[model samples]
Target: MGRMKPQTLLLQSKKKKGPTRIISVTTIVFGSLILLLFVLSLFTTYRYWSQRSRNLSGNNDLEDFDEDGEKFDRPVYAILDTSKGSIVVELFKEASPEIMDKFFHLCKTGYFKGMLFHRVVKNFMAQAGNSQRVEAAEDWMLDMKPQNELMSTKHEAFMLGTSKDIHANKGFDLFITTAPIPDLNDKLVVFGQVIKGEDVVQEIEEVDTDKLYRPKSPIGIVNISLRRQR
Candidate 1:
């Protein structure tokens, strides 16, 4: 204890010498470097999240994913084939071109095959995502980041909604509303609507859940098939 104090006092003192002064200078330099690094890291973190917020949740969506803007004006459809039955969804590509494009591609590649309808709330929504599959997904699947942005759309019954992280980044996680969700209108992007098989959505929501809202028997996606109506 006696020795430790003297060393701390020495560090605080302004006295100079050969080795002692050199050690003191070195300590000061190291401390200054640490502070600089901390400040830089804070700035960098802020910038990275700021840019992501703008890109992912801001007013804009990634440009018409198609090179020639082809998919933007079309009527894109996604059929979620489940154990209960098929739910046909009419995706609003014109409103969410980028999100629809990625959804279409993911459906085409069977990315959501056998994924559970993990969360179901009666008269609310049926939520699903191949989250565990994404963790072990190949490079190509990982590269197809599910980009999203909020639109002027509202959450009505049968509307498809995209999921967002705390950072407001979008992912393949998705939900379909079986009833109007007034509170979620500003939080999640409404990407599509169930045009057929509303009964299937209701049946899926009838699934029993534990405290975690997960279905007891594990209802799941057989696969999602995509098509466009011209």
Candidate 2:
């Protein structure tokens, strides 16, 4: 057989390599498509579960004003456990009696445990309270009727306050404002303060939040036990 020309050899090499290149490119493209689909599915799953969880517990009413309303006189300390660190909250009962009473009862009855720190407004506040238990949700929503009463106070650095809403969910989830969102003065309730863990409160506030005020990180209430401070 005549020796193959250099051009012929080169042409034969190109033909052999062409199919390999096509196969490699096809593999890469297919892998990327699969990865993209997996990511989308994961995101969709996460969103569905999150919304379902919020809506299911959203109907809970945490406040029910009785015929004879109760008020707390002494200061109370709440021990909070977040995924980041421990937070010791000091409630000013004198400043906001009803608000503290409501918060106290919620803590005493184990209502705030297992709930997530759902909202975190940077340099403003961190909000939590929504449980996995069906009973907790039922208790929360039992007294959700609208109350015209607006509990307002000075937005002091350590003060704790409930948000205003037609129902209880907004107030049930409490937060501490970092910057004086002065506009919020009339809208939110100032109930307590961070006598000890201002730094921890600020830490929580730094958590990433979504438009709905929900945190991107899954921070939860490890515990919510309170004690009457001297």
Candidate 3:
């Protein structure tokens, strides 16, 4: 072939460049689509796992509520038949299990039968459960010693009282609050609350008291009956 003309050479170059450019553009578009698809797939997977985790957490919460409901349904209650009147208390097992267990055991064994409300403070609390005064008692007082283990609790109105001394002696002394006693929270373990007949507690607090804050006459605990209900 003779020396090619400039136009011919230019036309050949154009023809070669057209297919090269098309191939480059097609490769870039295909690569971009692949990257976009990968990103979308990653996002979808992340969302699925996140939703699944939340669902599992929700289920766990429901299960916890169910367990709590079962315990709450069959709570242990104490009925105090006293001279003033009857007062019903709902013992919290979860808050102070050890103390409540001891209390229930005492009630079951007639340990609180004929016990006196030894210490009574107006607008504060009424303390009792001292088996020391029982006529037929023999080493029963020693058995009533409180286990002063500190448990988490709040000092609210109508709550029962426990103290370090009471725990030390393992004494079975329990007190019912007539008012809120937040000041005693750190020093006292409140294991139960008056659920019914709070007015009876107030009436007892207003009864006759001498210098020692003890009832002048006799504010006796006739008996303590334990009732389990659902």
Candidate 4:
């Protein structure tokens, strides 16, 4: 023990630093793992909350359409492709359930296709969906017999005019009013209103018409499509 060798001194120094270095490395690894786990947890929480918020917003939008004990989760639209132009109307199912059902059924079956806007009164309204009568005769009567009469006697009975029923005795005719007709409010069933392409309706209204308010040139409905709100 008189004098320690240089090699022995170096060995002792290495021994002295070994535990400290090991401790530092271990601490760094542990801290890094903890930090990574924390970050992952934050990301998971954020994703969960974001998804929940989106779900709640969608539910709130659906709730907005709830009316009179009926749920209208999404809006129904009627796109009329006429010779003049295209017109978009938003159907109010809650307002006129029976009329909307009939209209939608007719649209699906291509009933309105190639049918003329047979009746058009300036600043009043444009009417269509008289396919049977329109195609049957050139000079068809406006007060034609109800088409639904042959389908069912029960339906025909329901179609009889009543003071309280606006759609009474009306066939599957779709009428788009250019100006508000207060008297027709209770006398007619309005299933939808124009949301886009009001100018197209105006264009049809401005077209030359005969004495019976029928358009001189055929303004036929090429196609009709139904769309749901996004």
lDDT tens readout by residue for model 4, 56-93: 54322332433344535567667788898888876665
Q: Provide TM-scores for the models.
A: 0.57, 0.53, 0.56, 0.53
Q: Candidate 1, clashing residue pairs?
A: none
Worst 10 residues of 2 by lDDT: 58-67
Deviating ranges (above 4 Å) for candidate 4? 1-71, 131-170
* Candidate 2, lDDT over the whole model: 0.61
Clashes in predicted model 2: 8
Question: What is candidate 1's lDDT per residue for 1-230, written digit by digit as tens?
Answer: 34667777787665554454345888989999999999999999999988877554312233233533356555666778899999888877555555665666666567888888877767667778743423221322234322243323464688886754412444487778776655555445677889899899989988887765667897988987765541
Which order, best to worst by lDDT?
1, 3, 4, 2
Q: Model 3, range 119-152, lDDT digits (tens) per residue?
A: 6767667778663533211222233333354333
Better of 1 and 3 by TM-score: 1
Question: For this target, which candidate reaches the highest TM-score against the unseen true structure?
Answer: 1
- Ten contiguous residues with the weakest lDDT in model 4: 153-162
Q: After superposition, how far is residue 34 of candidate 4 from its true place, in Å?
A: 52
